[model samples]
Structure formats: C-alpha cells, structure tokens
Target: RTVTSKMDLLAFHTNTPNESLISSENGVDLSLGSQPLENTKVHFEEKQFVCSECGKGFTHKSALLTHKRIHTGEKPFACADCGKCFTQKSKASVLKHERIHTGEKPFVCLECGKRFTQKSSLHKHERVHTGEKPFACSDCGKCFTKKAYLVVHERIHRGEKPFECFECGKYFTTKSYLLTHERIHRGERPFTCSECGRCFTEKSSLLTHEHCGSAIGCRSCTTGILTLLESCAKDMRPIGFSLSHITYCC
Candidate 1:
C-alpha cells in the first residue's frame, strides 16, 4: 500500500467506508456528506475542533502542527538553555530555538535537583532514582528508560555505527553523537552541573554523568538499572552500558 517514492492521496466516501483516489496536483478534500444518517442530517460544519478537546487549537495547520507536541511525542521545539527537545515545531521557532543561544537551566529536577527546560526531560532524568525500564527490546533481553538509549542499544546488536570521522579516527553509532563529539575539538560546551560545577562538552555526556558518575557513579547508576535485567538472563555485562559480576581479566 506504500511506495518509497512521491504519491498523491485521494478521498471518497461518506458516513460509510469508501476508498479515495490519488492526484498529483489536486489535494484531497476531506469533506463530510450532505445526506442523513438514521433520520439525522449531516451537520457538514467546518469541523473546527475545540482547544479543550485536543488540549489546544491553532489557527494555522502549521500552528496545529505546533499544537501536536502535546501528543505524538514529538519535540521539534528544542531548548537552547538545556538542550531539551520538544515535539511541537513552533511558528516563532526562533524564540524557542534561540534559548539554546543563551545557555539556560530554568527547568529543575526535584528528585535530583537537576534542571532542564522540558518537563518530559526532567521526567526522564528522574527515572534514575525510581529504577524504571519502560522500553524493552523484543529481540534481546534488555531494557532502557529512554527511547534514545534503546535505539543505541539496538545498534549494538545490529553492529552498526554509521558515522566515521576522518579527523579524529573515531567512529560513532549515530550522527548527532558524532557531531557532539566534534565539539570537543571545538570546545563548545553549553551544559554545566550546578551541584559539582562540572561542565560537559555534550548534553549526552551530561546525561551519562547523571547515571554513570564514575566508579562510584557507575556503581550507583547501574544499581537501579541492573536489577531490571536480572530476570532475562540475557547478560547485559557489556562494556559501557552495563556491568558484570565477574570480569575475565584475561
């Protein structure tokens, strides 16, 4: 039903199920029927949804797109202050985007006292204490609280690292990660921890530090994270992400 190339969508049907046609030029019109349904005439109203219904309403389709951040779990609206991402791609994309211009840490974590711009991010950060593993891998016995970490874990099983940097002779599992690593050379660190006054080159590094601090850090961070995987017996004793009770030493 779907092709990799461009195609047009066509619509046809009323009250009942009907197929639509595809046209390259003319956009599909999703209009309601004029007929009645069980002694009830079709209202055929503009079909304008209310704000309270969808959480909020926007005047433009693009505005509606911005509104959809409340759903779909998309954070196109990223925070410059703390590198937190939001799903809603805003009209004045400049305002939200510019926050990144000035490093801000307005959003704070009540659990750990870490600050962030996006509430969703604070929620994710808090999971470290709660010891949550909501995202699990079907192929293997592994779990992660964050979707991004799950993706990175999938890449490990897939044995894929798409980005290779020529300058540093370093390879990265993802493009954005590789780009962040490049900042080390550029010295473009925008995130700093308030408690210890430790600055990080990448937001990801900052995130990792929150969980895996050091020997003490990894020990504490993995405490909550490790228990979640014990039932699987899949052996999460890998290098950076997990710990093993026994070390080969050979």
Candidate 2:
C-alpha cells in the first residue's frame, strides 16, 4: 500500500496485439498465460470487446474472474459489525445479506472470541488483539488497517471535505460516515458488546474496546505494562509470557 502522487485509478483499454506491444500505454499486460490469442473468440462492444471472456462460457469466464480477484481483491464493501476484514466487496456483502436469514456470526477473533459474519469484521477485531496497524497515511502519520479508514483519513490531508452534517456544522469526507457519526449526538447506540453488555454509539469504538478496554486508560506503551497487569491480576502466569507475546506479535 504505497501512496503515490497520482490520484487517478489504474485503467486499461483494449488494444490489438500490435498496439499492446508497440503503443505507449504501459498499463497492465493482461495476457492469459501461454495460450494463443486467436484460440478464443472476442465479442466487440462500444470500442473494443468490453468482455474478454464473453463466449468462454460460465466456467471459463468465472475462472478468469476468480483469477482477477486475486490480482485485485477489490472488496469495496465492508461489514459494519466486529471490524472484520475482507478482500472482496461481494463476499462481505453476501455475508451481510445472510445476516438477515441466519443471524449468526461465524468469524471469530484469535485474541478475543468475538464473532462476526465477515472476515473483514474479524480483521478489524484482530487489530484490537495485536494492535497491529500497518497502513500509514501519507498526509498524517496516523495509522489504520483498512482502506475506508484511510479514505476518511485522507480528508484531513486533502482538506477537501464534502461530508458535512447540516445539523451540527460538522464536516467530513463522506456523507454516510458523517451521518453515522451524527447518530452519536442523537443518542443512538448501534453496536452492543456481547462481552460486557456494553453498548457503543458506533461499531468502530466497540471493536476497539474489545481488545484495548475502556477509554479511562492509555493504549500507548500499554503493551509493555500488560505483563505487569497480568502479574498483578494472576501471579500464576509467568512474567515473560506477555513480553514474549508482544515481541513476536509486534
């Protein structure tokens, strides 16, 4: 996740074999293995064949699509619960869709056994466990694990705030996010923690606390203190266990 000066998306326009090799557009070279190009039939649209695997049938096209998902696991959607992480938007969406039917949470965190239907939820949960934040913002040093979190973060950097709450004169980058935050002032509790019967104004805070505990304490340099707390809480546990865990997990 290296940040670049360019804000435009990586785009591709179909070109013939001659142009793909000769033209200046050096985008992704999406060639299908060592297979011959003349073998598969192409379906033309607007300019070029928009669908490369058009006549290749369901299995053939699906396999290509599945392969593409590997290159770009563009899971644009995310779960509102448990802060689980995912690569595919559809997968997160499908799980959320199933929530209406089963009302069950399958994905669980390793540090704490919080359950969620989406893997993204579990990922956001694991951040609480290890406190591992690898995603760093280019504008600010503040770190986050998810892209959506980063998008909101970039608002501070770009100073292009489009998300504003008419009710409070507060501004944000995204409207949906601003509306969700506005609910906090409206006395709306959307996320309820199953661990301690505590409710949160937002899902993000709830996910954060499940691992870090309430806001009364400090999270910075707290990993060093956990061993002392463990020793104070349970003398039976060895002193080095916490240190060793943090050393390896960090």
Lowest summed lDDT over 10 consecutive residues: which window, candidate 1?
Answer: 2-11
lDDT, candidate 2, equals: 0.54
Residue-wise lDDT of candidate 1 within 144-178, one digit each (tens)? 99998898889888888979877787988988878
lDDT of 1 at 11: 19
User: In candidate 1, which residue ranges exceed 4 Å CA deviation?
Assistant: 1-95, 101-104, 167-171, 176-250
Candidate 1 positional error at 99, Å: 3.9
lDDT of 2 by residue, 46-74 (tens): 12213343433233544456445445655
TM-score of each: 0.38, 0.38
- RMSD (Cα, Å) of candidate 1? 15.8
CA lDDT, every prediction?
Answer: 0.56, 0.54
> Which candidate has the top score in lDDT?
1
Clashes of each: 14, 11
- Residue runs of model 2 more than 4 Å from their true location after superposition: 1-48, 51-96, 166-170, 174-177, 180-250
